[model samples]
Target: MVGVMDDNRLYAIGEVARRTGLSVSAIRFYSDEGVVPPVEVTAGGHRLYDVHAIARLEFVSTLRELDAGLEDIRRLLAGGLTLTELATAHLSRLDDQVRRIRSRQAVLRTIARQHTEAEQVVLLHKLAGMSDEDRDRLMDDFWSEISEGLQVSPDFLGLMRNGPLVLPDEPSAEQLEAWIELADLLRNADFRREVREALRETFSGPGAAMMTSSKMVAAFERGGVIMGRAQEAQRAGTPADSPLGREIADAYTAYLGEIAETPDSPAFREKLAADVLDIERLHLESLEEYKTSTDPYTRYQSLVAIIDGSARQAAEFMPFAWLSAALKASVSP
Candidate 1:
C-alpha cells in the first residue's frame, strides 16, 4: 500500500524510505550531508521528514540515478543551481560519454576483425587516437616528402595537397583498415622512392616539357581532339587495326612524335613506345598496390583521378598504348 500524502505530514526516516523506495540509511546519509535535511528531530533522537523534505529526497534520488555528482546535487539543493541548468549540463556530459563509448566500440571492433597481436592492437589504438588534423598533416607530410624538388605546376600541386586518403569523422571498419594500410604505404621507403621516380618520369623528358610549355598548349588541344575521337571509336567497338583505328593511331603517333622531338617514323614510334611502356608499368604497379590497401568496392574517386592524372596520365595513354602497338605493327618492315 502507498503512503498517503498530506501538506502537514511528517514521517519518520523509515517511513519516508518506504514511501520513496530509498533505503533508510540513504535517507539518513542525505540528511547528514544536508542534501535533504530532515525537518525536525523527535524527542527520542529519530529524524523526522516533512512533505517538502520527502519531495527533496525523491528529487535527489532521481538525480543520483541519472549519475549526477554529489556536489552538483548539493549545489542544486543549496539553490546555487537551477534544475534545468544542471540537467542541460549533465545531458551534454552524457552525450560526450556516449561519443567516447562509440569510438571505443569502433576501435575494438576493428581490432577484433583484424585479430591483431598485442603490439598491433596498441598501434591501432594509437592510430584511432589521432585527430583529424593529425591525419591530414601526416598525409601532407608524406606528399611533401615525395614531391621534394619536383617541378609541379600550381594546379598539380593543389591536387596533390588535397590527398585521397581522408578518413571520415566516424569511419567504418573498412575505412579504418584502409587508413591503416595507407599509413603503412606512406611510411614505406620503397613506395616513397617509387613515387619519386614516377614524379620524375611524369614531369621530365621532352614530352613532359612540351606538355608544360605554353607554346605547345595548342598541340595538346589537338591531341585532345584525337583522344576524343579515339574514345568515341573505343565506345563504338572499333578494332585497333580498323581503318578508323589506324587513322586515330596515326594522328596519336604524330602527336607523340611532335612532343618527343622525333620524326613520325617506325623507329621513333618504337622508341616512344619503350619509354611510355616503362612508365606505364610503374604506374600500373603502384595503382595495384594502392588498390590492395583500400576497399575495392568503395572507390576513392578523387584520389584515383589525382594518381591517374598527375602520376601516370593513364587516361591519356591507355588508349594510346593500344594505338601505339597497332601503329608499330603496321609500320614494321
Candidate 2:
C-alpha cells in the first residue's frame, strides 16, 4: 500500500470534492471518464488525485456553469481544443441565445398589452414569425385586391401599393399592435368592398382616369393657387358668403370647367356645386368612415391614403364637407 502522505502530495476523492466544492460522485465520475484522473490508486482501491487535478476539475465546473456541453468539455480536457477557441465559440452560442430570449421577450410584451384571446394570441405569434418580405407581401395582397380594375396613375398606384403600417423587426408593443390592427382591417370584407366601390366611383367621376402626369401637374398647380387664395381669405376671416369666397369659388369653377370640358359660367358653377356635394357625400360614406373608426392605426392609414390620392389626382376640388358648404354659400341665389 502506498503511504497516505506521499512525496507528490496526492489527495483522495473526498478531499478533492471538499476542496473544489464539487460532489464526491462528480469527482469520481470525472476521474472515471479520465477527465481529471487520479495520479495513483491505493491497494484498497481509493482514488488519489494529484494537486493539479483539483485545478482541472475546478475549470470543468466553471465551463459547465457556462453551459458548455459535456462532450465539448471532455474534448476540451483531452487537449483537442484551445481555451480561447472554446471560449469564442461558446460566446457566439450565448449571443444567439440572448437574441432568441430578447425576441421572445418582445413578443410576450406585445401579447401582454393586447389582452388577446387564444386565437388572436396564436395569430399574433404567427405574425411575429413573419419576415419583413412576408409582411410586405401581405400588405401588397390587400392593396392589389382593392386596387384591381382601378384606373389610377402609376405613381398613385405605387403609393397605394406601399402604404404605411409596416412592421418593424423586433417591434415594440405599440408597433406590434398597429400591425395586428392593420392586418385585421385588411381582412375585413366590408372594408374591402367599400374601398373597391370608392375606387370605382373615383374612376367613373368627372376628373376620373383622364389625369395623365402632365394634366395632374397642371391641376395641382391650379389647385395650389386656389388653395393659397382660400387660405389667405380664411386668415383674413372672410365669410363663406363674402365676394372673396365667390372669387375663390369662381376660380375653382374655372378649374373644374377645364376638367369637365365645359364653359366657366354661372350654369357650370351650379352644376359643379352639385357634383362637389355628391363627391363629398361619397367621401363621407367611405374613406371618412375608416378615418373616424375606433382603430387609430387603420384610421391614420385611411387618412394618409385619402390625402395622398387627393393630392396625386388633384381631386381636392370642393370634395370636403366644409368646402361644399363654402361653395354652396358662394354660388346660391
Q: What stretches of model 2 exceed 4 Å from their correct place?
A: 1-8, 146-333
Instruction: List, residue by residue over 2-108, the lDDT tens digit for candidate 2.
Output: 23444478888887777788999998888787777888899999998876777789999999889987778888888888888898988888876764565556557
Worst 10 residues of 2 by lDDT: 310-319
Query: Candidate 1, overall lDDT?
Result: 0.69
Best TM-score among the predictions, by candidate number:
1
Q: How many clashes (backbone atoms < 3 Å, residues ≥3 apart in a chain or on different chains) does model 2 have?
A: 0
> Which pairs clash (backbone N, Cα, C closer than 3 Å) in model 2?
none
